[model samples]
Target chain A: MITKLAYKNILGNGWRSLINIFILSLVLTGMIWMQGLYDGWSRIARRQMQEWEFAGGHYAHQDYDKYDSFSLDKSFAAVPPKLQDLIDTGDAVPILYSAGIIYPHGRLTPVVIKGIPAEQNILRIPTTHLRIQDPDTQILPVLIGRQMAKSINVVKGDILTMRWKEVNGAYNAYDIQIVQIMDTPVPSTDMGQIWIDYDKLNEVKALKNSCSVIVLKNQAASTYVGSPWNFVSIDQSMKGVDAMIQTKRVGGYVFFVLLLFLAMIAVFDAQMLAVFKRRKEIGTLIALGMTKRQIIGLFTMEGTMYMLLGSVLTATLGLPLFFYFGFQGFPIPQQMSDFNIAGASEPIRCYYSPIMILSTFMIVMAVTVFASWLPSSKIARMKATYALLGKV
Target chain B: MRKLLILTLLISVSVGMVFAITAEDILMNIDKNMTAKTTWSSSRMIISTRRATRTLSSVNYSKGNDISYSEYTAPAKEKGTKMLKMKDNLWLYDPSTDRVIQISGNMLKQSVMGSDLSYEDFMDDLELLESYTAILDNDITYDNRKCYKLILTAKTSGLSYFKRILYVDKERMIPLYQELYAKSGIKLKTMKLSDVRKVGNRWYPMHIVFKDELKAGSGTTIINDDIEFNISIPDYYFSKAILKK
Candidate 1:
């Protein structure tokens, strides 16, 4: 009975009720869109990281620390015989790392030298470009990421002087031609890094059959690796990307609260004014044997009904916007690449999951009902005579 | 008979002079003037960057090339910072933190106090003749003095510089100018030695400048304000414990 009464009241309120419904729907739409953006960014970042750098897992030398550049020289270990079989069978690839400096445009810049096999398909890096033959071995073919190439101001065919210390501490330097500039979304595989043929680098460093990391084709390939090599799982590798998305999500909370606040204030103001102007109606309901609790419930139900109608309107109004963004994707700016974020260079397609929609709806409805009930509770304190005369 | 004797004497003297100086002999003489058995010195290092220049003063004590200690004495920001080199191990004590850190492996190759010189350069204690094979290229006039141009190739793989082109002052047996090259034949650094001074029958350059070819800067100059050769240095000066003291 109260539900029917509340529905009639919402309709009787006319344009005022329509305005409240419109505001609620807009807030819901904004919340859903923001959620979709975060979800889309997180999804793309993880996928791109897996594609460009971490394939399935990494078997890194125990001494190798991603944070410590100084560990590059001492972190290499002899490839375990079992893991070597995987490499030979194309299920894995060995990578050697060295700390080096490159003179690009005659300016010295520090770089991390990564040596990957030319024939390996474990990662998306264009290592095949590193296979060119150099007559007399004067200038070796090397690969640089686009960001690295840009920062150093070089392009394909530009020769840079690369210098590094050998395993025995002898410094070796040579001219390196940039055969390819890889456009990788993952910063770890790119910025301040150089890629060369694995055999050539190993030979130059005089570290035979040794590597700093063995990238596996899948998690199953890790079974072949053993001591002095620690397996870094895919989840473990995505920690950086996850942390970045989480931080962004936390930062979005303030915006979300403001949107919710706008809708709540509108509903709260309407409910307070309705209580003030309809005191005679409230007194008649009390005189007719309707309880104060019942009257408050009716008003609260009306505010919740606005949310329910707003949800239906949101579905109607938000469907086209969601579909457009879902298919077309939101274009990311080019300058975002400087932040070293994975997938920041690519468009993020919004993902509107059912759970995300339902939760947002429930949260907005609860706040709306609370705002309605707070003002409606004043009916319990009103005297039937005073309300009957339309006095406060 | 007198004419024949005079001609024989002239030819014999010329032959003796030609045989007197070989590449190895010149290297030995240069090494004797460059290195010392024990030495103590007060020096100032001036490092120049594109933006500005900084000068630091220090007192140095050394026994051979393998063991040495330095403590910065001037520039309040750098004062009390000490470095001790024992063989391949290099430790730095920063008074700010009162901590000593051992720099090893590739860390030794990094510049010292942002200077053009690296710890590896200071840790190199081997005599030139022990680590390199010298071939005399030719004679050249350098710094208005007759100098022997010699090319030295590393006899082993682990030496800092693979090849060094040195211009040795013929009279003083000190290298006036040097070009340090990597194995790839690219010149990595150049050094100039000037202000030659004699102490106890040995010639030593008091002013040395080192320039890293790959870096953009005016380079670093080291001036030895006071020096002593073959003098007894306190044994405690080279100890690790002395870094904190």
Candidate 2:
């Protein structure tokens, strides 16, 4: 009986009830869309980082600190025998890095020279471009990222002079040719970086079989340890991005809560108005032998029914919008390509997991019901005689 | 017999005059007039930027071309700063942090104390005669003094400047002007020395100006206020421990 009356009353009010339901539906859709986009962005970013830069993780010399360019001189050692076996089996790729200065068009800019195997398939870097076996040309072949090339003002087939300190503390300089300009998402591996063949760099430095860090294919397959070399796990390597996502997630929650609060206010206001304006109807129902507690229960059910209808409205309207967006991913801005933010340069495809959708639905519904009940509970405090006379 | 002997003597004298001044002879004379076995000097470096000018005073000690140390004595903020250069290594001591950091790699290319000179320039200990092959180009008048224009080319691949043009005073064997060039023949920097004085048997320039062509504004001027050559500077002065004092 209460359900029939609540349904009739909601339909009877028409536009007022529609407004409440519409606001609630809009809030639900916005929350779902925001969460899906955030998830998509973070997923792409983590994948790019793993594929292009970290590569499961790394085993680095103890003094090999990426932040300290000064440490690059002392951060190299001969590849350990255990790690060497992994390299031979194609499970690892050794990388040697040193600080260098390059003069492109006679302008001096600092660079980090990274040497990796030209034939290795360990990392996603396009190292095959460095495999030009030219015996007659003294120009060393090098690969640079697009951003680095733009900043240094050099393109493929351009020859520039590069200067660096050898392992013996002697300086060496020579001309290098830009063979490729890579397009990669990770800026740490791209900006201010130069890629060369590992063997050639070793020959130039006169330090055979030495590397700054060794990248592994599988993080969990080895437990290698030594005095000067230590392993960094994948989670440890990506901790910064994880923390950044966590902070953004907290901000998303605050925004969702604010949206929920606005929708709840509309429901609460409608319930308060119903109790005030429908006193004569309440008196008539009581006069017709309905108990006062039953009258309160009816009013409460009326208020809760708005949320039930709002949820149905949200599903009918939001699912189609979500599907449309899911098919056509959001376009990333062109300027975002210059940012150091990983994966932001790529289009974000919305990811709507069942768990994320279900939880969001439950949380919004609970808030809506609670918002209805708070105002309807006032019926219990009012005197029945005063309520019947519509005197509050 | 007297006529034949005189004719042979004249021929020998003419030949000796023709082969007298080689590139090595001029370079050795310039090196002798430029450096001492050990020296102590009080100097001031004045750097001028577009915004303002800063003057720094220091007491410098050096042995040959390799080991040198300098402690900033003025401009209160830089008073306790010290630098020690031994061979290819350079260490800077900052009193505020009480930390000694070795300047290496790319850091060597940065300017020293916002001056036109880089730490690499400060740590460069290569003697011109040992690192380059000099050729006598011509004689030119520079700064109202007759100068021998000599061109020096790097003997190896990795020297900072691949070629340099130097003008040495004909009488004093002191360099009056120099132009440094990169491997691509780009003019990188230029130095002009003046205020020549006779100290002992050698003539030295008391004032020098170094200009970095890559930058704007006026160049850096280094004035040797008081200098004592071939003095007894103890070996401990060049040690890293002296930086703390």
Candidate 3:
């Protein structure tokens, strides 16, 4: 019965209820949009990293430290015999890293030369371009990314000289012909890096069947772990990316809290004013044998009804806008893409998952009900005679 | 007439033979002129880059060619920084950290105090003839003085530079110009020596400039304000314990 009364009261209130519903719906829509951006970005970052660099995970030589560039030369170890089977079967790819200097147009710049198999399909890296008719050609065929090409100012088919130290400390130099310029979003794979065939690099480096890292085709391939080869899981590799997103989400939370607070405040104020002006109605309800608790419930239900209606309005009006972002994606500005963070180069497609939407709705609805009940709870202390006279 | 021509030709040939020196002899003299048993010096380094220029003053002490110690005394930010070198090992003491850290392996290649000079450059104390085999090229005139161009190739694998082209003053036996090269035949650095002065019985360069080709800058210039060759330095100065003290 109290619910029926609350519904009728909400309708009769007209414009006041409409204002409250509009504010609630607006806040909900904004909250969901902000959440969709973060979710979409995180998802895209991990997916791209997995596709381009870490297919399943990495099995790196024990001495390899990404932060320590000096460790590159000594980081390689002989591939364990068991893992070699995976390599032969095309379920894994071995990579070698060498610290080298490139002379582009006779200007020197330090670069890390990574050697992968030309026929490897384990990762999205364009190693097929590294395939050459004769590996023993005096000029080595190399691949570089767009960012590196821009920084070094080189184009496809440009021949540059590269120098590196052998395992025994002898230095060698060769002419490298740029075969392909890749457009990769991952900065670690693109910037200050070059790609060449694995066999060619090993032959020049004079190391047989050795690699700095082995990229597995799937998580199940991690069983081939051996001494001097440590398996790095996908979660471990993505820790840095997760921390970055968490930091950004913390800043976004403050704005969301404020928006929700304003919506709740509007409902709270309206509830307080309604209780003040409707003293005669409260008295009439008491005289008509409706308990004071029932009267409070009626007011509380009215506030909740506003939220319920807002949710309905959000579903009807916000669907098209969500769909637009879902389809077209939000383009990242050019300035932001240069931040060196992975996945910033690509557009972020907003993903509104059911769980994310439902949780947001529940949290907002709870806050609204609490705001409505706080002001209405005062009726429990009022005397029937005093309320009839409209005395506070 | 034939007898007179033969006599004149013999005299000319004899003069050329008497004046010419072997590459080994030239290298030995250069070593003798540059290396001292012990030396103490106060010098200033002016490091210049495209963005800015920084000047640092330091006191240096060396024993033989293997042991050396230096402490920066000027430039408030760099003051109290000390470095000690013992053969292939190098240790740096920073006043801010109050700790001593050993720079080893590939870390030695890092620039010192943001200058074009690397820590490996400091630890490279082997005599030129000891590390490189000298080959004499044709004579050339530099700075209005006769100079012998000697191309030095490294005899070992682990040296910082694989080859060097040195221009040695014929009379003073001091290197006036040098070009350091990598094994790939690319010029990596150039050093110019000037302000030649006789200190005691040996000739020395009071001013030197070193340019790192891989870096973008005008390079570093070192000026010796005061120098004492063959002076006895305290034993404690070269000790690792002095790094913290």
Candidate 4:
């Protein structure tokens, strides 16, 4: 009976309750999405570093620091070409990064230039629905992010040009058509990013058969660093992402937490006000000898229902995107050329973790239900004589 | 006998010319100094759109000499990836292998971390006298500095970057500006080093600019804020093990 009464109360303030529900829905969805973004960033960096065979380890904080006297030419000179072969036989896949401006369609923004093998890129790269086929034409066929479409406002068929300085002091330009503007598993990759064949880049730079990183598959995968390869491991290469993900997660959490907090506050406030407005109605129930426990049960049931409905609506709208990320991943922006946090690699894909789901639900329920408790308990404390007289 | 004596005198004259310049000739005499060697230790904060990493390093070298060595402190992201240098040689220590390895060949031409110069092509400060014939092109003025524009052509057929025109300050003989050309005679890259400052007993160019003429893509300008030289630097600091250290 108390539950029915609570339901009628929520319906009486229908429009306001709906606005509150919508706000709560956004909060819940955002909380899940923020976590999603974090997982996506890590997953992409980890996988790409492994797949691309970035020369350094994925998690290790390897510093390729050049001091004041260190010249650009000498920094490249510091890491010799012979070390790659020695490290390749080990557990890591090292890749070097190059950042430059492209000139395919009238100079796109600066992009992350990933120097990697086409076949091996699958390991660390988040899965985009599009298949990027290397084209054999005067225009270099390139792999780009989905955000390339948005930033430059370009589409799939547009021909974009890429530029690089040749060793002989000439600028080399490749007028490549975008073969794929695929979705990356992570949103951060949605900018203007391009993946050129590393060998081709070397040919242009006049440095053939050499890369700068040993992106590892595991921490203990390789231990022999000479002759064939010399590099840090996968865990070693996440130097860029550790703090990055933490900060991003913190921001994401704060946004949703504050949002959810406000929604709960509003609910708690309204429910308390509703008790006073319905004081006379409560007094009548008390005079009829309705137990205090019964009244509290009614209110608790009503609060649970509201939470359930809101959660259902949020999940209904959100789960499909989650499943899509699990299956057909989203594409990143083309401009996000340097997505390798700590030199890991690009195209990190975040999958659904059961733990994340479980915790999110718990937090959402706990906040909403806990906020309803104090107000309902206050109503339970009233004396029957005062309650019937409507004076308490 | 006269001819033999004459030839002997000429040989002596050439040999003496090689070692004639003293530290006094190269230092403290010029009205404006151009470039010098410097040693530095610093930390870098790199921020991408969503990520940030800090890297620390100690570096040493002479500017005009064309080579320097740096010891890298691993970034939070790339731990166990070692970076090292000795003369022209570079090494990246791989903790996975526990071995100090040598960096060699083709990897040299790349711009270091997107810097203005190719880390591979410029290291060895190729002995100008040995690799090319340096001809005095003309005396000109650049940025109000009295300068000599020099044309350097490879003595051998296979030297990288077939020709270079350097606008060097006459007084300091520092190549203040340089234009590099390809075998096709196409202008390829331009470099300008300026903002000279004295660090220790020697004066050095505190700024460097590298622009790639060919790509029309991207370039770098290095501005050195603080500099020192010869801080009791140890030769062992240039070793491979130190790269990972």
Query: Model 4, stretches more than 4 Å misplaced?
Result: A1-211, A216-220, A224-255, A284-298, A313-353, B1-245
Relative to the unseen true structure, what is the Cα RMSD of model 3? 4.2
Candidate with maximal TM-score = 1
Classified by CAPRI criteria, candidate 3 counts as acceptable
- Among residues 3 or more apart in sequence or in different chains, the pairs in candidate 3 whose N, CA or C atoms overlap within 3 Å are none
Give a tens-digit lDDT track for model 4, residues A1-392. 66667778778868867776676677777777668767776776655544433423432113333121122222232234334554455443334445445544433255555554554532445323122354344555566666556666667767755554444433445565666676553333445467666566565566666554545545444555453233554454455565677887787788787888898887787667767777787778877888888777766666666677778878888788677765655555544543424222343345667789778878988888887776889888898777667766
lDDT of 3 by residue, A143-209 (tens): 9988899899999999978877767655556678999999888888899999999988887776887
CAPRI classification of candidate 2: incorrect
Going through the candidates in order, state the TM-score of chain A alone for each one: 0.95, 0.90, 0.93, 0.57
Give me the displacement of residue A124 in model 3, in angstroms: 2.6
- Every candidate's DockQ is 0.57, 0.20, 0.27, 0.05
Number of colliding residue pairs in each model: 0, 0, 0, 108
The whole-model C-alpha lDDT of candidate 3 against the native structure comes to 0.87
lDDT per residue for candidate 4 within B1-245, as digits (tens), equals 99999999999999998865532332223312433343554433221111232232323434335445544344534445555555567766666677776665435545455444555544535555555666666678997898777787766654656677877766555667888765445565787878766565555666666676644434555556566654555655555446556
In candidate 1 the C-alpha lDDT for residue B195 amounts to: 97
Could you tell me the lDDT of residue B115 within candidate 4? 44
Q: What is the lDDT of residue A43 in candidate 2?
A: 80
**Candidate number with greatest lDDT:** 1
Of 2 and 3, the candidate ahead on TM-score is 3
lDDT, candidate 4, at A96: 41
In order of lDDT, best first, we have 1, 3, 2, 4
Q: Across residues B88-194, which tens digit of lDDT does each residue of candidate 1 receive?
A: 78999999999999997657767888888887887877788888999999799999999999999999988878899999999999999999998779889999999
Q: What TM-score do all the candidates reach, one by one?
A: 0.90, 0.77, 0.86, 0.46
